[model samples]
Target chain A: MNNADHPTQSPGNVAGIRRQVVLPLGKSIEIAYNSIRVRFFRSLITTLSLVLAVSFLSFVNVSTDVANGLLATGQPELRQALVRAGYDLAPEDRRADSSSKQRWIVLLSLLVCAVGIVNAQLMAVTERFREIGTMKCLGALDRFVMRLFLLEAGMQGLVGAAAGALGGALFALLNGFILFGGQAVRLVPANELLLSLLWATAAGCLLSLIGVAYPAWVAARMQPVEAMRVEQ
Target chain B: MTTNKNIVRVTNVTKTFQLGKIAVHALKGVELEIPTGQYVSIMGPSGSGKSTLFNMIGGLDKPTTGKVYIDEVDVSQLDAYELAWLRCRKIGYIFQTFNIIQVMTALENVTLPMTFAGMRNDEAIEKAMGLLDLVGLGDRFQHKPFELSGGQQQRVAIARALANDPAIILADEPTGNLDLKTGEEIINLLQNLSHERDVTVISATHDIKMLNVSDLVVWIRDGRIDKIESRDELTISVGRIDARNA
Candidate 1:
């Protein structure tokens, strides 16, 4: 009888919520959206911080690429004059990318972006400790909890990054025109600038995901009793 | 009691917590069996390990040694997937703080567990509405947790607990946050559900009034079962339910 039961031993025939399937991804996304909507002001602050950080980083990247593109147009006198004025021009052969100094600025901006994301995600995880516990008690799997947090972070990051990237690229274009006049538009390096914007937006999403990974793991692995024991 | 009739079995269970350099034994080879459909209450002073024992039975925590069996399946040996399966279908939890999803409406909160159970959306909503009506919150379906009174929030919680029609209901201090009058009402409701639905109700509580409705009361002292008494033996034990001892 024991072996006979083994073949048919999914929890019960009445309910289909066993190991065969998990809560739908769409439902988790809906829950994530609703949670963000419910905490409108908090979500706003998190998105705003992402926006500012991504904008700064993207602006740096775009302007650097524009500067490099204009410097490589084979104008030696112009380049020397620019170099004399404290501009660190790259070698002619390597005038294909942002300067090393500007790359460091990009890295710095990314660090600041990561710090902003970490703060927002950490706050979200702490606030949802009890809720996470309750969800676990209600049969939400570890993957489900992780997915819910990632979904929220991804949604916020995507929106903020897209807006920030576009805003930064446009502003960078305007700045380039002001500094180098018609020469700037003539050597716009539109492809490189667009690539930087894309990279910045992707970085925003990736960093948001990475920022939430630790907290999500912690939440998913928490003993429900320990989580529910917390009063606040 | 025969193992066949017992729905829950705790055998030689020992749980140790590491607190700094000290090892605190929460349960020391504790053995217990709860028959199907019994309304059991676990009572003890704080730090006496009753809550830890409750956690073991509820599958919220695994014992460091020995095993827990729910419906003949060894729960301590189950993986997370199987644990979630058991929690989703076999047992329901009602927290003292009424841990309903705070952002959703009362109706939405009750429907959540059903969704985890893979019920259809409309069907889940219909059942959830019925449950709310049963808990006397039918008219307040749209109210969020903050919008409801304490008693109302707890009623919603109870409704949520019953959403999946779990065979076992675990209430951890269900009436702890309510006033005496409301507390009594919640207790009566639980008692009625226990008899009416034939579901096993295990409540870890300090409310002395629970004695009136319990089928069995298990008292824990330190890390061991001090006594186990049926409803018939409760009259003799009622005098022992002191504030410090409970």
Candidate 2:
């Protein structure tokens, strides 16, 4: 509160004050992390939904591959069942059909998970009206606000994707081992398994970024006065 | 530091809002000049556009047809990014709700603006501590907003508003949520900041007590300035009225 300590006007300081850099990336990410921590249950629910969807997708992919491989063994009972169902198809044809169907199912599941993410993020944005306003009043650039939300969504996506992939892989391994004993190891292509997990992770991250884009934009464009006037 | 030059100038500023196809005039060609290091209180009833005018001066909103100048620089001419820099470096805002980010500690809340201004983490923390101490909240640095009382929370908000060392502090009904005694303390704190630091402090308030401490009191009605008088003038007018009644 000392008068001398606080200068009323700094000589020739007008133009110098205008050259503000965007907020540091590290600080924005830290704020996003704190926000995620504050709303732990909400974020967890959104992430868990993502995990389930992703895991189901991976499971479809792995299970179809394993199923196709098992059919290739020329097991009489399985072949007879196929015959009873009037397929009477070769193992190669069945594998191709299953691969196409798995692709469709994975695509469908991702769509559903994307919708869930959008809903969750919208709700988050609505709840944080005052918080966003406060940030803006504190001189946060719009891009900084947008980046914080995108970073939060990215973090959730990464966690959910990793967990989902691992869960799906474990399920496939267990199901194969229970059914086909020593042959299960050979049927579940270890290399393909690694690639699918990576794909799932990438897909999850992309989906999250897309889902949060609208809400982040809305938050970034909010007028500070109007936002603060919103009833909490 | 005290100067005759006006730190803020509002020139026939008028603001209109389109609310559901109906035009509502919030400010009606209001003109005023706030000199450097002055404590000015804008007093009006609800819906008198005090808050709207405060927002214009603070650069939170633009006037519909008039200009707002801070240090003689026209605010309306600046782009969004420039306005943000102006808000960051030249003006601080305190709201009635004491809008501290609830998730952060008091110290963190105070440091947020500095952080946005690109201050390094260590320097920001050090300055934030000083601000907190200045507002008498040094002991509550680590406390969250929910853990503090209303007055304490408002003190934290005040510290936060001062974070960037802005020359102008715009407070919109800062004591609207506080009790009488706490409200007085906050008013005293603001007055002291104005007097000691040579910062221009402008507040919009319904509290009559604020008029006693303000160097100038502006009365508004229906989005227009009804009168502007110094505290001494107001006191003299009141004395004349009291003598006539007696």
Candidate 3:
């Protein structure tokens, strides 16, 4: 008998309707969104860390340009040292110094942000032990689980980066106006602001993905039995 | 009670866990077969390796030695991806703790397996709703796991187990967390699914009451099969004893 005509056939059966199995991106996103919603405070805290880091990075970048400009007129030796260290001494070069010090600051801030992302994701994986086990038992491939986590991290990064960019831009604008008056408008160039936003967002997204890699691998490799044994 | 239609076959399956330097043998060369569409119960005391055997049959774990054949496919030989496909499409699992994702609603929980199987969301939801209705939880679909009663949560779990129309259902202490009456209802539901849907229902449980509905009760002790008894044989044996007493 056909499944539809069979007495035992459940409403759940989409018998005879077959489709090639593709990655369920939409469902994965929805599940990730639901998870974020459920752990709203924890997710918020993690995202906030990214926000603060990105904002700090952007603000420092802008303030350095302003400081370099001031130093250019005051200390010839300092300006020469900064120029040797790769600062643009030319007044038109608003991009300022790509000095080793600035690079160090950027690297340190990113490192801190990356560590925060890893810690948050690791805790999240630990908290969802049973949930992960249940998903594995229900036929979720390891890659599927990994994708879900990566997507979650990406979403957090995207939102956090956007917010941080806005905050940094505003901070730089206000601080410059207070410090340099009317010249502050010209100090924060439109192109530079846009570029900073783009770079910060890209970096945030990349950092988040990198941070989740180890945790996602650990979660994916967990045996269903071992994972389920964890206290809910 | 061997049959040509054996759907699950196990041959000398042994599992060992290396706990630091000590090796703990969970299953010691266990061997068994379960025929198609049968309700088989693995009954044993705690720590007797019944759960380990169940996990083996469900493809959740690999045996240290020997093999497990589900639908004639050597589960031990299958890679992770193949094993995941087998689990997603051919086998369903119910756990003692009712391992429904707490963050999801009953409908969402039920839809998860299908989602992993690459079914579209709308189609999965429709099927999930149907499965919930079949399990008498249509009204509880919107409720989260914590919001539902123990019995209702288990019903959602059962619906989820049936989500992919799997041929084999592996339940590890399916009713362990429920009260007697609720446990009985769950057992009745499983029994009906086995009989009517022709799905093989294999459970590892300590509850003796499960034997009443099981076709074959396999007794296990110390990681070994002590005996295998069919329900009809049990009934006949009971009848003879009652007659002698009379």
Task: Identify the candidate with maximal lDDT.
Answer: 1
Flag regions of model 2 displaced more than 4 Å. Answer: A1-21, A68-89, A92-99, A185-187, A230-232, B236-246
Q: Chain A of candidate 1: what's the TM-score?
A: 0.80
Clashing pairs in 2: none
For model 2, residues B88-203, the per-residue Cα lDDT tens digits are 76788888889889889999999888887778899999999999999999988999889999999999998998988888998888898999999999999999998988889999
In model 3, the Cα lDDT at residue A171 comes to 87
Give DockQ: model 1.
0.39
What TM-score should be assigned to candidate 3?
A: 0.85
Candidate 2 chain B — worst ten consecutive residues by lDDT sum? B78-87
Ranking by DockQ: 2, 1, 3
lDDT of 3 by residue, A14-92 (tens): 2322222235677778988888889888889988878888887777666565544446355556455446544456845
Better of 1 and 3 by lDDT: 1
Give the Cα error of residue A46 in candidate 3, in Å. 1.8
Clashing pairs in 3: none
lDDT at A20 for candidate 1?
A: 35
Candidate 2, residues A1-232: lDDT per residue as tens digits?
Answer: 3222222244344344444535787887888888889889889998987898788777766655555565666676755544453433664554423456567877888898889898989898888888888888888778888999999999999988889977986787677666656575576556667877887777778888898999899989977775447255
Distance from true location, Cα of A151 in model 1, Å: 1.2
Error of 1 at A32 (Å): 1.3
Residue B188, candidate 2: how far off, in angstroms? 1.1
